[model samples]
Target: MMWTKCLCLLWALSALCAPVNKQRQRMLLISFDGFRWDYDRDVDTPNLDQMAMDGVKAQYITPPYLTITSPTHFTLLTGLYVENHGVIHNMWFNTTTTEKKPYYQTLFVNEWWDNGSLPIWITAQRQGLKAGSLHFPGTSSSYQGEVAMVREVEPILYNYKNETAWRENSDKVMGWFRDQDLDFVSMYFGEPDGTGHRYGPDSPERQEMVKQVDRTVGYIRHLAETHGLTNSLNIIVTADHGMSNVYRNGLVEEITLSAIPGFSFRDIAFHLVDFGPSGMLLPKPGKLETVYSALKGAHPHLHVYKKEDMPEHLHFAKNDRILPIILWADPGYVINGYFPVQFHKGEHGFDNQEMDMKPFFRAAGPAFRKNLEVGPFESVNIYPLMCHILGIEPEVNDGHLNATRNMLVTSTGTRGENRSILQNTLTGIAAVAGFLAVVFVVVTSRQILKRKRKDKRSGSVQHLPEEENTKQTGF
Candidate 1:
């Protein structure tokens, strides 16, 4: 009876002292921007290839829209489409306003902060875990909850001339990774993306670019292994969208952002000058059909959707911020203005079976079941999958929860079924937990402030926000 009593006491003490859910493991999500699963004849990503051989490789991972950087990267982290996440295109749209928007009105930090999308890092932070992004899009500004973000300076890939800059920045990210004891780290590579933009998808130059990125990835992998972090690490390698060859001669007509009556241009994304990209059209009072018909008549090759007519699968609607018409350039064509823009071996962005289909996913780590081949999941599903591994809960994200059966081992551990439920539960729990944690931090901080104020009353100097350093004694 004494032994039993002692054991019970010890168990209770252990429960009180033990870390919160130490079963949670570490995760590393890396994106090789614009990287296609079939970049090389051999898909010469030896390290990545090995990861697939050892784990799971998704062949066709569709991106949200235009496959642009910001929205696509957002989808990767949040598992929502451009329509659902609100980062519809590379630019931001204000469907709320009735005033005519200027030709170049991009949403800055303040507006982006108000977006409804909840990045996974916010979920991780609430669960009392560390999260960091090396150069993921949407990190430059603040996100809800806690996250360590290195803002993206140049959001788009201009040309191959920026290759050196990309490498330098990537190395800096590696340095950051080395310096931190992070449980989750996201490192993004923009080489393939840049090469894809410049020389087109099938360019030998693009192939070479992937090789260069492969070297960097190899170095990162070596770093993980040498530091004994690989055992607990689950590496998720993916891309925003695939590249296509665009021939400048194929364009029919050019319409500048200035040409559109109410449309405004924000980001410098090349795809913005399409049949009519992601923004709302008010149609000058009752001229809605007239305006729509004129635009449609002008660009027959373009596909347009009334916000209400958008496919249910898209999970989009005629929201205030949504552009009335979404454009898809006819296959083998770009808009007219970019006609003289030199592009080799073009790729299409329309709903064509090929261009819309992005690369696959490859995950290797203890959290994943080995030798799994998930056919093709919507880009949005990545959010739940990520939430599952991190042991963080997320809301019922835009995409459905896909089972990772291929990656699971044959243990009767109930982990397989738990993944879906776990993601749903974790999302809600993390959200609530994060809010509570922030509240706790704020209250504690306030209490500390009151104590400091009391101390100051006894003639002690207290350091406050941006106040003079009176606490220092003339040092």
Candidate 2:
């Protein structure tokens, strides 16, 4: 019971020191969903360009396999690959019941997100830091029975292309930082992805959305600066995956699984297709080999493999949630199970190795070096970098800090952040100790003065014994 009180005291102490930790440097991770690395290439983005000028920029960052939103964003949050994190797709499903939920509804499924890994929000909060998630994917779910101190989810049928709303979210998050004193935040923008899906990635609509995203970036910085966070905030802007133009109008070969002669949905117990270029199938008992044989070499654009024989580079087949048969198509084509139901001009979920599926990364703030563009790195490595910036020990993750270490300022090195944490903690402790000492001296002096006044009233005054610069405990 004594140990429990001690533990509680330590937790309270850490919470009381959050203001000091804020001075150590707060971290904000922003995700521009499906913002392709090259989207900014053709568009004139002065804000993004200025950000690159002031801080670190990467040529590109690779998302994990199954290059979709939820799984890839989960990778950013947990530093685990899609297979490891177990959020295999945007939608949650049960093969037995054939039940499924859309992306937004799936956000509330705690079991889906809390499989075995913890997002940085949970880890940060557990370590005595306050964190918030602003409409970020997986924000609605809790991990290990604990949720972020603060979080917001986008409303149903929320508009994803409103520049004004984007700025509002930016201002709101900055307010959380300044007023609520949050240590870390993960903010999300459902931009360019929606525009890219509505109009092809190369279309003018998508280009316009990129311009809006850049302006939003500038607005966020303006808020950060206005809130007096310029000296104490580290901001990382990245995305889940990139966008690609879908091949259509009958100009190119299409991959329709239902059209295959031997391939039959009747042969499969559960299947996921038409979501994008990727599809997964769990054949009925004893039908795995038959399904594999039927789908293999069925279409030149579609690549099918048994879960066990999936390529070693793609760490997607290990999880039990993954279906027995995996299928994906080349960049231009998308796989459809029953005719071409999808009509989006743009698509993702292609091979991560494909250039079109790669996302961009940019970071700025006191902790990051200026005007630096780093080489290519995987998005998985970002989790460790954020942990380093927040001075919190990261949970077991597949990411490595060395991948992004070169981007940090010399003063914000690995040791530098840890030292800052220790220094802030010691500073808090010292301030508390000094305050207690002052209280002790003041209380003691007050009692003595009261006794002296009473003695004077009685015509006798006694003095306190003077310590020779040492106390009972030898100073």
Judging by lDDT against the true structure, name the best candidate. 2
TM-score of 2: 0.84
**Candidate 2's residue-wise lDDT over 296-335, tens digit each?**
9988888999898989777898999899899999988999
The best candidate by TM-score is: 2
lDDT of each: 0.60, 0.89
Residue 42 in model 2: lDDT: 89
Residue 32, candidate 1: alpha-carbon lDDT:
77
Clashes of each: 19, 0
Each candidate's TM vs. the true structure?
Answer: 0.70, 0.84
Q: Model 1: how large is the Cα RMSD against the reference?
A: 16.5
Off by over 4 Å in 2: 1-23, 413-475
Q: How close is candidate 1 to the true structure, as a TM-score?
A: 0.70
